[model samples]
Target: MKKIIMAILLLPIFLNFSGCTKKTNEIPKTSTKIEKSAIEDKKSKVNIILFYPSKEGSSLSASSRLVSFNNSLERTILEEFLKGTDTKDTLYIIPKGTKLLSVSRKEDTIILDLSKEFNDISTENEAVLNNTIYSIVNSLTEIPGIKNVIIRVEGKVPKINNISFENPFKRNRSIFNRDKTSKPNDILKKQMEFESQGRWLDAYLLYSDDENNTYRKYFDDYVKENEEAFAQGFISKNFTVGSYTVDNTGTHALVKVKFNDTNRELNIGMIKIEESWMVDWIPPQ
Candidate 1:
């Protein structure tokens, strides 16, 4: 009876031991599954990152990010005006979408690596290149360290950002002011002033005077009364030569005239000067 009881207890103990061993083996398999899930989650996180990728991406591009600095004086005109986004350590530069690349900086000048896209530049496309370069230079200057930037394509230096292969458009003109830009003719004005002052030349030179011109008749009478004294002074004084400029076209110049010390302003019609700009008073019909 004692031997039978002892065998039954030992049998129960052995069965429990086998069960525990099976569970232990399963734990390792479960742990492996958990490890695989964690690895997959990490990969997904990497794909979600939103920065401009590395140089080995679909097309290599190196663009600057506009950043802000504490030194306010270094901020360029463009930087000051276009200040909406965060630029705290970001340097703004023109964006690029090309596969080719190159960068060379010497002193204050920086040359960019260019490709075929820069071949034939258009007016609209110029903005991109200009603004891009401008942005880079502007940003760089803000560091209080660098100067301006010069861009070159295919190892050749170019004046403009892009040039057209065909005959290009004419250069646009600069704006001019009407009031301050032009100077008044002092000599012609003096002649007109003398006439208004009642001094006139000889009637012989005046040929015929019409009844219509009140000022003309007055001057003729003044000439007749003053005689040689008026003739000498008036002829010499009335020798007013108004000037007109036709510029490069050589079309005509509008000459403004004033006689003697008179404040009256007179405008002579433009004259046609062949192959050059000429201005003269339009002779009375």
Candidate 2:
């Protein structure tokens, strides 16, 4: 009778110890599952488009990148914009040492408060100032549901030259290096045709508004100089159009053209302007 009672007591103790051991092992597994779920959330990503100035500072170039998605997505984008791009032949238009102070959204507009360095760009030159503002505006407006951007320096709107930041700035499509509607080859062919027909004004219109081009700056002088070439048929019969290759940025291209009745190939530089490609530089015949 004494042996049977001891055996029953020991059986209960063994069962209780086994139950405690199982609960301890299960605790770590449950914790591991929760940790895995949190890690998955952190790994989530979303695609975003960023705009930067072209190396020439004549137009804006669009770059697409994947960024982590979270509650502070807008802020994250602005931070990325400030960090600039690694793309060659592109420029980070934002003033160096500039910092994003804060960001908030109201309806369709996002207000960006930036450090004082943001206002230190060259305001005297209209193109430079316009490019600087649009680089930020165009970048943020790429976000869905965000139609405009309001820029502020030190919590207050700034007036730089003719541009006033008191109101929300909308995205300007004219500032982009290229749009979806045009091809570089087609544009170059059209320009050459216009030149062959002696349509000087038409050819001039095809040229980009590059601040550095003397022909664009002195339109009358360009036409006067080209008159003799047009009369001699030199401009019309110089080269035959050939194959072309565009760069990865899509803003620049190398077009090949052959000298008339010769095996000589001349490579011309083409730059995208708005929706059309414009001859950046044409070599002397």
Candidate 3:
């Protein structure tokens, strides 16, 4: 009888140990599943660049965000663009109620279908129309393996004035205002060379005569003042152009130059005059 009672007591202890082992193993399995799920969620996200119209409607500005990677990435990008940027200086270029209907991809191009509201932008000015079209094109083309974009409105190609959506549109970098046509670095270099050589007349002629220019007076007075300043060592002869950036309008630029001898840096203002870049103002040291 005593042996039977000892056997029953050992069986209860064994059962309790077995239950504890099972619970310990279950905890790691559950934790492992949770970690794997978090990793997959993290891997699904990617960063994408988006373009929008500046507040002035004169140029395109770029913004970036993270999105889920999937077959519908193109549609997702378009949807994010329609939602617009949160930046106060940029505006959504698409019509308010426009919707992305579908997204398909060919060899190197992404084809987009949009709602009828996209076609309702006929009353917008040319700049607005251009911004709307290129904002979509540029944003999509930024994706890898995408070279062009074709936009269709309600299953039909759209044509507003001379602009047409029947053909694939490539990214237009000129709309970013950083293209070769708007760069003012070369003009600033030439003006610096002229000033260094004491050719005041040539340098003065590089100034814009636009009515908005408040820096220049008469041609004779400009030349005389520059000559006197050079004789008095007011202008440095040894300088190097560093870097420059053009304004959003593409009509104005600020160029940074370093005086090699004196180790001083100054910003020179430039303006576009007719077809040429001209020096509008120089900061007084």
TM-score of each: 0.22, 0.49, 0.51
Report lDDT (Cα) of residue 19, candidate 3: 62
Candidate 2 collision pairs: none
lDDT for residue 38 in candidate 3, whole number 0-100: 88
lDDT against the true structure, each candidate: 0.34, 0.66, 0.68
Q: Tens-digit lDDT track for model 3 on 207-258?
A: 5545434444543345445655567565665678768888899888888877
Regions of candidate 2 where Cα sits further than 4 Å from its true position: 1-42, 123-125, 179-285
Candidate 1 residues 1-285, lDDT tens each? 111212332457657678688676564544687787885664332100001112222211122332232222222223332332232422323223322245544654444545545444334444344443444343333222234444455655544545332231221111100122232333234333444354333121111122222223222223334443333342223324456544465443445544333443345433332222122223421
lDDT of 1 at 105: 49
Which ten residues in a row are the worst by lDDT in model 2? 1-10
The residue-by-residue lDDT of candidate 2 on 1-285, one tens digit each, is: 111212332457657678688666564544677787776764675445567777667787766566676466578778878887898877665679999888999977899899998787663446766786798887776554567788999998786778888788887778764434657666777777787777665565455545444333223334544655566444634556777888899788877766554456556677775556777743422
1 or 2: which has the higher lDDT?
2
